[model samples]
Target: MILDRQLLLSNAQALTTGTVFSTNTIDLASARDIGIGDNLELFIRVIAPLTGGTSVQFAYVTSANADLSSPSIIVQTPPVPAASLVAGSEWLRVQVPALSDTTSRQRYIGVQYTINGTFTVGTVTAGLTLDREGLAVYPSGLNTAGF
Candidate 1:
């Protein structure tokens, strides 16, 4: 099953085009059974032509209800030296082990990017999917039917 999904930059610009951000969230009401040994995977695409920035920086935050009480984790992807965005886009895959044994009803994933020194918009279109047996979180591909 899928657990989460998001698109940080839609109209992705070049390293010199400034910064942009977007996000999405997914509910875990159906994923209460997910526990330890399971992992979280994310696929991100930075649209093309990032401009006006020394580099693109992606940041991630995990929470339970968009509240401060929710446990949060941060992850970041630095910029590449290529500077041309040869692929037109890039993908990010992440995994979070069962840090805690809690079965949650909702898990929030936040994402943002900075261009040189400024932060992008906010989390939009970010989502989470379910991974029941931990089988779907492997190296294969995303469980598309989820979330």
Candidate 2:
């Protein structure tokens, strides 16, 4: 068994008020072909000095292309608390639910966030963890083979 944890978004991403930040799109089919299983989870962390009425939310989006349109929010965190911002890093973890039977199912997956109101300088990061099941063969010494 192999474990794969991919960082979809790094810490360099800055939040913009009234704007949305989206991570790179992931090709689920290719990921599965490369031994990534259907079971997946998202880990999100945010650090910011947010004032009252300032809110942040995380969601999963599926699109045919990188330019997402009419996106559907699969899962999201509750609005960030104004007091929590001063406490420390706000974290959220969610499991990806079963996909639909349509062609868009498991096609492209990505993380997106929306920020509102005034926010102090901060960074956000998100990652996807995939559990790979099966033997990892290697043609060369110490190197794992493709699934």
Candidate 3:
């Protein structure tokens, strides 16, 4: 759950009707190449409590242009309930697909949010992370203890 500013997409962005592109777009062709390789995850958290809204849809987009005009959708999340969006909670997490993933990636990577209904109060913060260790802690099977 480590957040990096350089990899940040949105910063407490206020959700409104229509679509809004993230403030930052990551350039994979650059020297840093933040979102590349086989395993990468984008973490989104609700920095401000959401109220008076129907839902919001999140998606990662890629494009050769920095403006992200008519960008190809990389991956998207289903519409999320406004009630579930609270401060200090995860709104959504997107796993950066490989170059050969279902959608595929471009030279630049960015994020976008679409507000479905009227949102009187809502904001989100997002960024990419290199760690997947946090997701591997779930215990899904019974332990074999000399059974």
What would the TM-scores of all predictions be? 0.45, 0.65, 0.78
Give the lDDT of residue 119 in candidate 3: 85
Give the top-scoring candidate (TM-score).
Answer: 3
lDDT of 2 at 48: 50
lDDT of each: 0.43, 0.59, 0.78
RMSD of every candidate to native, in Å, equals 11.4, 12.0, 4.5
- Candidate 3 structure quality by residue, lDDT tens digits, 1-147: 566788898888888777878888888778975644536788778888878878888888888778777789877889988877789777557676676653466777788888878888878888788875344476768978898
Q: What lDDT does candidate 1 reach at residue 49?
A: 41
> How accurate locally is residue 22 in candidate 1, as Cα lDDT from 0 to 100?
40
Which regions of candidate 1 deviate over 4 angstroms? 1-21, 29-40, 64-71, 79-87, 101-106, 117-147
Tens-digit lDDT string for candidate 1 (1-147): 443213222233333334434433433444554333445444454444433345566655555764413434466677643354334344344664333544422365555545564323222122233332223355857677857
lDDT score, candidate 2: 0.59
| Candidate 2 residue pairs that clash | none
The TM-score-based order of candidates, best leading, equals 3, 2, 1
Native-to-model Cα distance after best TM-score fit, residue 74 in candidate 2, in Å? 0.7
Off by over 4 Å in 2: 1-7, 29-35, 47-53, 86-90, 103-106, 130-147
